[model samples]
Target: MSGADQATRERLAEEIRSLRARRERLVDELVQSSGPGDSGDASQELQGGDEVAAIDERIAELEKLRAGRIDVQGVDPGTEVVLRFSDGSTQTFKVVAIPEEVLAGEEDITVTSDSPLGLALAHGQQGETVRYPTPDGAVEVEVLSIRRPS
Candidate 1:
């Protein structure tokens, strides 16, 4: 990896850490706000429940990211990759620790490190073939290329 690429990866990792911390703090605050024995209005309690649920979902995603943290010298998170299937088909996807909600409606596809294919592709090099087992059987994919976003 180039100096710039390494720097970018470090920045992204730091961002993930920062976001996780923020979410943790938010969850704590929500828990405190919705504590039992508090004589709060029913509507307020209902709203708090909704907020808690949303925060819980976000926390779950962050935990997945924390568990999938990678320190490999190659194929780090945030790298765009092209995979060639056995039948001569190719697909492009961005390897991300967590999916970016801003790109939710975009055409770009992202794969998290926790996923089966993502786990197999992590730290892989160009021209390397990775096989992952599925319900039907095993699937083999070739890493055609890995590129850093511009």
Candidate 2:
């Protein structure tokens, strides 16, 4: 596994832990509602219980992935690249070994390590040009820079 891949796995595992906490809280609530002598609306509680169980199952799957993680490594600490998509749109991003900063009211875009673009960017060097095959012909882009996630 690559260093970058290892870091990404660790980061993802942390995120899974956070989500698991939420799922566990919901499970506790469901267990309490399912206890005997409860005269409340059991149907709604049962629905919620099902949802919580599903989420817990999902978290468990994530945990399994974390345990058997494989990743790309040895990425330089100063890699940055500009991605030009097929829609004539472009964005610059850094291949960091950590999660991006949280923004207020802004959605986070987590680029998967398995994605073509992300993988290409991961192997790219500064000033290198990479061409990606898209549904509409091909998209060409240049690597402006590279950097660590820090």
Candidate 3:
């Protein structure tokens, strides 16, 4: 594990912690809003419901990320890696526990650790070629480089 990788893991852990805190706060607010003493406005209730649903979804996502969170010691989840395909084309992807919306607009691709390619590349090293099952057929990709999140 490199220093950079460790730093990335630390940062991710902190993010998870922060998200958990936010979720808790949201839950508390939802409870307060739905209390018996609260005003019985239909629109307000509907809005509160929507907010709770959204917060619940976010909490679920955060839990998934926490469950799949990776350490910095290996080519596991949470590592950013570059691969060279058999056709001589290269691409970079960040191996995550769950696909993050924040990475959707980024240059690099984000792959979940449970995905075929990510599973094959788990614990892989640079210069190693790993085979993963594809829709067309099995494909082999070589690990060109591995980088931790900045």
Candidate 4:
């Protein structure tokens, strides 16, 4: 893996940890705020508190998923691989986490370490290839090299 790619992955892992911590803090606050409500306005405030708690819960879930990384075992961080589609065309892609900028979209293409294609590639050695079936058909991908992102 390139020095830069390693840095990026480490940065993302740190970000996930930070987000989890923030979510935990928010949950604690929400729980403390919703105790022994007196009624009327208090009930309304409790409802609001609960809503905030729900949001925090969702954030926590996302953070957990982000933190629970897949084992790229044999695959190194910087791997130059190809995805050969059923059309007999191949595209080069380096497997990595979904960039923060691309998180809202392009998620499938970004391919997480846990994703089907990503997982298949994970632990794969150089010169090894795997095939995955898509709606279009089956595509075979070959692993050329593995290294941390550059």
Clashes of each: 0, 13, 0, 9
The TM-score between candidate 3 and the true structure equals 0.49
**Predicted candidate 2 versus true structure: per-residue lDDT over 39-100, tens digit per residue:** 46587687787787787777776665556544444353334456554465667654433232
Leading candidate by TM-score: 3
Task: Name the regions of candidate 2 deviating beyond 4 angstroms.
Answer: 1-20, 35-46, 61-68, 71-79, 82-92, 96-112, 120-139, 144-150
Candidate 3: how many backbone clashes? 0
Question: Would you list the clashing residue pairs of candidate 3?
Answer: none
Which residue pairs show collisions in model 4? 1-147, 1-148, 2-148, 5-149, 74-123, 77-147, 77-148, 78-147, 78-148
Candidate 4 deviant stretches above 4 angstroms? 1-51, 61-78, 98-109, 133-139, 144-150
lDDT of each: 0.65, 0.57, 0.67, 0.57
Candidate 3 lDDT, 1-150, residue by residue in tens: 222244444555676677667767766776676746545554576776777677677666555544554342223556789999878999988765544432536625877667788778876789999988989999999999987545
Regions of candidate 3 where Cα sits further than 4 Å from its true position: 1-75, 148-150
Give the runs in model 1 whose Cα sits over 4 Å from its true position.
Answer: 1-75, 100-102, 106-108, 148-150
> Order of all candidates by TM-score, from best down to worst?
3, 1, 4, 2
Q: Please report the TM-score between candidate 4 and the true structure.
A: 0.45
Per-residue lDDT tens digits for candidate 1, residues 1-150, read 222244344554666677667666756766666646555645566775676677567656545444544343324567788999999999988765444321444434677655677778766789999987779899999999978546
When 3 and 4 are scored with lDDT, the better candidate is 3
